[model samples]
Target: MMNRHQLPDTLLMGYAAGALPEAFNVVIATHVSLSDEARARLAAFEAVGGAVLDDDAAEMAEDSFDRMMARLDMLPQANARVTEAAEGIFPAPLADYVHRDGRSIRWRSIGAGVKQAILRTDGRASVRLLRIPAGQAVPDHGHRGTELTLVLQGAFFDGNKRYGRGDIEVANEETEHTPIAEAGEDCICLAATDAPLRFKSLIPRLAQPFFRI
Candidate 1:
């Protein structure tokens, strides 16, 4: 019900400007759906972008408003992408990529009661949904690049802090930790990483290439 972490303004601005990679975009879009603060910030960023564009453009024609409305109407709902509505555990934007029903998803077991479903993306980054059984701990790992993880259900705690539903944890090359899910319910996260993780465990290191985690 409450979020302790959210995307920074720079990242939200990148999302508003459509400058983020598709994998990251999915995480933002899904997070925005769950966060009112993020939604408001995104709207503010979009408004600034719109104002900038308007100031640079030539004088508006008399029918510009109508024309724009018509264009928007002609576009697909997904293309407009103004907001992500809650559908199931997956928000509207994420639902477009995979089945809302968890049972239908093709999840691959990673290890230690952890499973993942990799989502197809443009390859600028990798996107995956991670499901960790309650009380299970993911192996200790360090990031080689940026990692964005948005909790969709339940919660997880690194040694330092806990991230619950609607909270997004941003980690970079300098970060390293082991995340364990809270008791009672499984933790589901939408995660995007620009580079492969550096697992400390020998077994996970050997399996990294095969799982692409």
Candidate 2:
């Protein structure tokens, strides 16, 4: 169970309404796959949307109901089976993107015992996977826009709080901190950002263009 933090209600509603960008959608879907609480919340938001539609007074064509039923019949079931990753490391939605077990990830070293793999996503946002060695610290940085980081394995502490598996850190322009991985195991996180990060150190700022962190 997730204990650190939950996705913001605005994001949950956007996900339920299918209004989020592909990058945000991917992160939310993967998080929901890992957290029963998130899944239940998403269901509640969808239920609210359905109720709103039911109360709408718009007139419909004579065959609209039949067409809707036919479309529903053609749609794939919501509970359709997804191929599970080994040991359940990657959630089903994420597994579909990586198409491999976590250990088999093609990691590119980003220096300081950290590795990353960028994921292709639509729109202006960027998505990536970060693997930080035990006790290693990410460079101090602030956000230009918003960043959503979901812990897939192990844990990390960002001075103010500790985030473990299934937990999400919602960082925005107002936040700045260095995240250090907890000892004992590597910390793996899925992150999405809408703009370039604001690095405090000169080294990180200079390397930002090349690393795209």
Candidate 3:
């Protein structure tokens, strides 16, 4: 059970309808894998969608089958054992995007003991994994668009709230926060942003373009 933050029904519905950007979908998929509550909620949405489709006598386009077949070719194979928990922290879905686990990632440092590995995604949005050392704070910033952050390991505090593993924080232009990883362990999070962030300070702003943050 996710105690603090859970994926909103709106986002879960969007994910069910296959309307979200691929990067966001990745984050949602991984979160669903980790949280039983999220998985159940997502399943409800999918069931609703399925019932709706069944009740509607919709005509399929002549090319629909061909298009679906093409899409299936692009998706994961039905028999692949890629969604289960790995020996490392990464679950199957995330590992499919990255690799087997943390060791497979080639981390890039961005100063202040923070490191990140940008995941390959479509140009519509960008996603990455952030490793914040214990007790260190990410630079204060606002969002230009939607941002989805999921804690994978350890914990962090932002806006007087604590987010631990499986907790997802959703932020938009109206949200601004400085997230600090808690002590005792490093915090690892998978973050997806639709647009670049709004930095409050000069150094991070200056370095933003270089990091493609």
Candidate 4:
């Protein structure tokens, strides 16, 4: 029952094909864990991929069959439980990375009643959790590359739209807006970015290097 927003079709397809960067994959996987509709859509893409493979005309080597079976045996079981470390707020895929209760998260202050915890990710892109107090506003900024942000709890309004739990905001260099958490509750978001943000304010621009936002 997703009510606010959904991942874009391009992102969904890239995730299904395993072609996204590690940071992007993490965001997609976590969103899928929370949205049954996303899961079904991803399954459809996988089915189409399988059908295409079945129609492949190239002949396989004699040892290919045995090697494939051996590889299957080496793969971990799909039903293995994610760690019990995370509170229910985190979906299982994200829980695997945090590996601790939400309250235990070490948050770093980023001014203006906002806090953040950077999550270790592969390559140039980065993933992190952000907590913004109710009514607080994130600095007005645009993206240098791409940014995918998923709301895990509460809500925020970014001038153009309101995003609540399970909503994802996809932004690129062309987009810039000040996101303000709604009045009643703090907004918790899982965000991934491929490059440094483009800040408008002089103070934010100066602090950008130190905060790595």
Candidate 5:
């Protein structure tokens, strides 16, 4: 079961409606793989989707609900096998995203606790793939522009908020906070930023130029 604050209803609805990015969808898929209650909720979301498809008055464009249903039907049924398969596929969910050929990631280590892969850059803003080990602290920093983070695996705590898989966090230049990874698992996140991160301390300041994230 998902904890009370685990995944927001908006994200769950997006996942069920097939409206999320592929990377974030993979995380929601993994969560549903782990929880029967969440899976049932997803099923409810699909039912709502069916209702949308049945709405004749809307006259929307092709929603591809049938295609999505076909894919859902193909998903494995055995519980053990489903869990194993989802776990196996977790690490490489971005395979298709990376293979599109136009985008690439440049991995660089910024601190003892973190390593980052610069996934794409438009000269101004950039996207990154980041991993911070269990119990490690991400530097207290703010952004020069906007920063949007999607949690792909594990959990992290910042201030009073605890973000888990499939959560999308939007932070801006005005948001300055430090986060610590939970004790049991590493925190892996996809971060998109429009400008350089502003380091808050001497350590990050010294490492900023050499850091890739």
Candidate 6:
């Protein structure tokens, strides 16, 4: 089986509430494809979210409930059946639209010690996999829009907070964070970056044409 990690509660909560962006949803879907156990946990969280929504029924807008129910009823059952059939096969293809070249990930180096590959480009932001070697730092960068990252393997410290497997970190224009992979193994993460990263180096500026990060 492929190495899998459980998601942090915060991310699970955001996913359950449907607050996560669409691009990030593709990464979550890939992780779901890899780990049934994690999917089951997220399912439970969704159930709890449903229960809470029910409990707050009185506060919900009248049309909001009807709209939600309408949308639910409108969903095609065929898609659910197809997904179930696909899950039975499990983890072989990496993901529906991702490029895979064997067990070890194929990475395109973007900066010093930072390598990435687009798992799936959904016409919006590319759903990407990133690896940073221990003690390696990325270009001290910020985002033009929201960025969502889910740690898959190893760990990294960003702005004093340590993120491990399954921890989803959200960054936007308001925040600036520089991450260095923790010592031991390479830090591998799945992220959906909505906008181009703003780099702070001349090397990154020159290399930007060759490497799209």
TM match of model 5 to true structure: 0.55
Clashing pairs in 3: none
Q: Compute the lDDT of residue 177 as modeled in candidate 1.
A: 74
Q: Which stretches of candidate 3 lie over 4 Å from their true place?
A: 1-4, 58-82, 100-103
What Cα-based lDDT does every candidate model obtain?
A: 0.88, 0.85, 0.88, 0.84, 0.68, 0.69
Q: Which consecutive 10 residues in model 6 have the weakest lDDT in total?
A: 84-93
Q: Model 6 misses residue 101 by how many Å?
A: 8.2
TM-score of each: 0.84, 0.83, 0.85, 0.84, 0.55, 0.62
Ranking by lDDT: 3, 1, 2, 4, 6, 5
lDDT of 6 by residue, 140-191 (tens): 8778876777777788888677888756676778767788888998988788
- Over the full model, what C-alpha lDDT does candidate 1 score relative to the true structure? 0.88
Clashes of each: 0, 0, 0, 0, 0, 0
The candidate that wins on TM-score is 3
lDDT of 5: 0.68
User: What clash pairs does model 5 have?
Assistant: none
**Models ranked on TM-score:** 3, 4, 1, 2, 6, 5
Which 10 consecutive residues of model 1 have the lowest summed lDDT?
A: 77-86
Off-target runs (Cα >4 Å) in candidate 5 are 1-93, 99-107
lDDT of 5 at 86: 26
lDDT of 2 by residue, 1-213 (tens): 112579988889988998877778878988998789999999999998999888869779999999998899688767655555435667877876675344456788877878998777776788889999999999888898878999999999988699999899888888887899999999999998889887888887887889888
Q: Tell me the spans in candidate 6 whose CA falls farther than 4 Å from its real position.
A: 1-22, 30-104
